[model samples]
Target: MEPALRRAYRRESEETRRADLIAATQELVAEGGPEAATVRAIAARAGVTAGLIRHYFHTKDELTRAAYLSLMDGMTAKGSDALEGVGAAPEERLAAFVSASLRPPVLDVGAVVLWAGYMHKVRTDPELKTVHEAAYLAYRDMLQSLIAALPRSASDAQLRAEAIACNGLIDGLWVEGSILSHAFAPGEIVTIGLRSVGAILGVDLIAHSAMLPDPGKILP
Candidate 1:
């Protein structure tokens, strides 16, 4: 092969390898917790050699860190997509944002455990801490803006505080919804969460209670 052709072939091969590595990380993390997403497991899932993973990521932490960022990126993208064109009302938009942010491409227990493990790492890893903080801050700012757009029933400062509180409520509820057994279906957690937060924020959410689906009977 010509020199240029050989170079192009190598570039394509490198891209494919990188894609394989990332895909493997995503699969393992979505199917098992962080521990199950070891370099060995990722390599096996990718059908690549462990040496290849080592070639791309020198340490397990490095691989996990990359996977963590990827997971956040995916969630952010989906959440943003969910909020698009959903602004008929401040309340509606806020609900759209929260629902999008909580729901994910994968809803399995292993995926929730994987997220929790990465969240734990981000709480301590300085390099990853800022990324996690920024994501949360983005969500908080969005909710604050939505609340700010509401009627002037409260002062700006009061609204801001309420927004922050609302965000805290969302954070706690999202974790609960993600990990809790599927005894309750999607949106059930959201319903209970919205009611609780609405009471805290002095908002009237009871009217939406009728919109909530029944917590279906537990299956065998």
Candidate 2:
């Protein structure tokens, strides 16, 4: 069978090509929707033959699924870096997580656009549902672990409740902050988040201000 027209591949490592394809799909979906990331469109945007997509991904749906995961992975990958860089103290790690979530890239409007675009598909598409469910749990579980690790006295049920509360607080603040980035000063989200979640979990987040990844960057 003849292949569709696309630009020739330039020098790129295997990982780079695959990442490029996934990223191309994200850009397309972010600009339009899931329907915009057709194989041909992805190939043309990636500057590679459509066959190359098949080489990396067996089907267009597979490519889309990979792209969906790519977006989800990007959400957490930076969180991992921020946590690791700050050392293992529970308060510091929690502070880092709070600050990172409320900062740029995470707090920007583009992230909200991409997430809302795919959120509808998650309800109807099984593959996307699995990705969404798993990622959501993973994030919540990370919070659960952090909540449990905090140097406070709490039971299993109490800790789980605290984690769930923190998750909701973060999610709500993320959307509201992303959309209204102009309204809140930089770091305001972090301050408000830690304060709110701290009350939810009975932790003194303000005392941990020194542990914040970006301290006092928020202005009045």
Candidate 3:
């Protein structure tokens, strides 16, 4: 696609313009992966020049890193929203976090497409790997906090192991829910994932069953 010149960017705040560029990158990546999200393509989508993108981000890698971070930040923030409710029981909050991971917005197809587009690069790209690791650690820390809030206290080492295992369960179920939505009934993935993770953490998620979702509500 050819780049379109837009004078409107001249009046836009730096932050706004930067966000536009990142959003453009996400759109392209979601539609056709990195090869299609080239600087030129991003510029076209954002209606900005390649030079302007360089001004905000020093290099292509820098911009891509920023975009990838943006993608992850939005996803994890929404995914962790169930933990944000005030005064909810720890068990319920835990269930919310699991449900968030397997529900809409958090389990969106476009977001999953963007994530898959970046997954291969994160392994070999140093900057991207750094971003991915930081996101991963932050999520694990969030899980640790949730686990620590439980009635039954756990040792630090045990909590760490449980966090890792629980995160694995969430991530794996996330893949299935996003790509293979037909395999399980609506909300079933959330139920199964929470049960599996509750087992790994020795936390009775089922006992907190009142907090879990009603299957009929999550229908596609």
Candidate 4:
């Protein structure tokens, strides 16, 4: 192959291998949690040698991080849809952000399970903790901007404090909704979360309840 063709071929091959590894990781995590997404198991699923995973990821930690990021980045890409076609009213946009953040894509069990597993790991690993914080900051910034667009005036400190509280509440609800399947009905989780969050942020989420997901759709 020519140099350019060879480069293109290599890029395609790498992408394919990366996709294979991610798919394997998802399956392993869903079936056996994060611990099962080992290099040996991933390689066996991908039909590649364990050395190939090493070639792409310097360490097990690196591989785990990559897998976690790939999953989360894919999920966060939907953030754009939060504002799509909605009139740019601050409250409307804020509700959109809240709804999107709280709702899990329950259509795919593997995705949901892997996401919960990675989230659990982030609590224990320093690097993953940083990554998790950065992701939350990005999400909260969107909410902050939407709040800034509101007509009501508030001090910067007040707004930041409210945003932090709202984010924390949503994050806790997410973990519970995603992991503790037996404890609460999905509907109860969303209803209570929306009500409490609305009270804390001084926004009436119930009025714009159309944006909220029906808990029936949220159960995988």
**Rank ordering of all candidates by lDDT, starting from the highest:** 2, 3, 4, 1
Using TM-score, rank the candidates from best to worst: 2, 3, 4, 1
121-216 in candidate 1: lDDT tens per residue?
676688778777776677677778867765447787887788788878876666676678476674666566656666766664444333323222
Q: What is the lDDT of residue 28 in candidate 4?
A: 74
Model 2: runs farther than 4 Å from truth? 1-8, 216-220
**Candidate 4 per-residue C-alpha lDDT over 1-220 given as tens digits, one digit per residue, 9 for 90 to 100:** 1111111123338877887777777777777778877778777777777897888778877777777777766656564475676665666666666666666562234566787788778878999877777767777776677766777878899888887888788767776766675677655666666677779877776566564342222222
Tens-place lDDT per residue, model 3, 1-220, is 5443333445589889989888888888888887787888788788888888888988878888888999887877875765664246888777777777778777777778889999979888988999999988887788788888888968999889888988888888887788888777877887787789887877777556464443223322
**1-220: candidate 2 lDDT, tens digit per residue:** 2343354769898899999898888877887888777888889888988887888889987877778777777776666667865767788788777777777777778778778888878878898888887887778887788788988799999888887888889989999999998898767887898788878877776677676555656433
* Candidate 1 vs 2: which has more TM-score: 2
TM-score of each: 0.68, 0.89, 0.88, 0.74
Q: Which stretch of 10 consecutive residues in model 1 shows the poorest summed lDDT?
A: 1-10
* Candidate 1 lDDT (Cα, 0 to 1): 0.62
Task: Pick out the ten consecutive residues of candidate 4 with the lowest summed lDDT.
Answer: 1-10
Clash list (residue pairs), candidate 1: none
Candidate 4 matches the true fold with a TM-score of 0.74
Give the per-residue Cα lDDT of candidate 3 at 213: 49
Give the best candidate by TM-score: 2
